[model samples]
Target: MLKLGVLASGRGSNLQSIIDAVEAGELSVEIEVVISDNEDAQALERAAKHQIEAQYVGPEDYNNNQDFEQAIIDDLERNDVELVILAGFMKLMSPYFIEHYQGRIMNIHPSLLPAFKGLHAQQQALDYGVKVSGCTVHFVDQGMDTGPIILQAAVPVKEDDTEESLANRILEEEHRIYPAAIKLYAEGKLEIEDGRVRIAK
Candidate 1:
């Protein structure tokens, strides 16, 4: 089974979805541990509720971004994590850490990525008057949400849609496709080529 280390910063609704999928036997993977930069992150609580190892490594404890990432890397290595999933981790990973994990790290972004590639992506879509918005699961690289795309699920943006409403809709798709993307990776069905991901049959 694939061993996973999840990084998150906030409510971790996506983490919950992954846990539910695992418990339901919908995916063949082990959530080895969850590490958060926020000590009070609900993601840690969710992990504790599931009896998975939960850790809090705040950046304040470290001297710099690289040090903070190194702490996380140590924890992940200790747990023998094969894959790293960023549900909502607010930190930008350092190039050193990205090189350490390389293609093993994945993140779910709330926009049809290569568009609205940074924070508040839902609001960006709303502000841009886009008719369609969605979520993307992609490999994590040095750039902000500019990694190779794995899977994306689109939702129509209503004329009356607020950022919150649009985000809520996109989050539903995030919960669905993030796990499906992990399953695809675990089954060795993903191949990265020419700045994109190719799903193998």
Candidate 2:
């Protein structure tokens, strides 16, 4: 089974999805640890409920981004994590950290990537008047949300949709596809080539 380290900074809805999949025996992976920069993050509580190792690594304690990332790396290595999942980690990873895990880290973004690459992605889609909006699971690279796409699920943008409404719809798809992407990685069915992801048979 693949061993996973998860990073999150919020309510952990996506993290809950992964835990649900594992508990239901739908995913073949082990959550070695769940680390959060925010001490108050609900992700930590979720992990604790599942009896998984949950830790708080405050970025404030470190002098710089590199030191913060190094602390995270040390925690991950100590747990023997094979893959890193960024469920909703608010910070952008430094190149130093990205290189250390390269192609071994995954993140779920709220918009069909290559579009709305950063925060408030649902608002971006609504502002652009897109007929369709969705979520993406992709590899984590040096650039913000510019990594190779692994999987995506599209949700129709309703004409009267508010940012919150559209975001909630997209979030459902996020909860679905993120774990599916992790499953593919766990099964050795994902390959990266020339900045794209290929799913194996």
Predictions in order: lDDT: 0.95, 0.96
Please give, for residues 67-144, the per-residue lDDT of candidate 2 as tens digits: 999999999999999999999999999999999998999999999889998999999999999999899999999999
Worst 10 residues of 1 by lDDT: 61-70
Whole-model lDDT, model 1: 0.95
For residues 26-102, could you state the per-residue lDDT of candidate 1 as single tens digits?
Answer: 99999999999999999999999999999999999988888889999999999999999998999888899999999
List ranges where model 2 is wrong by over 4 Å: none
lDDT of 2 at 193: 96
Clashes of each: 0, 0
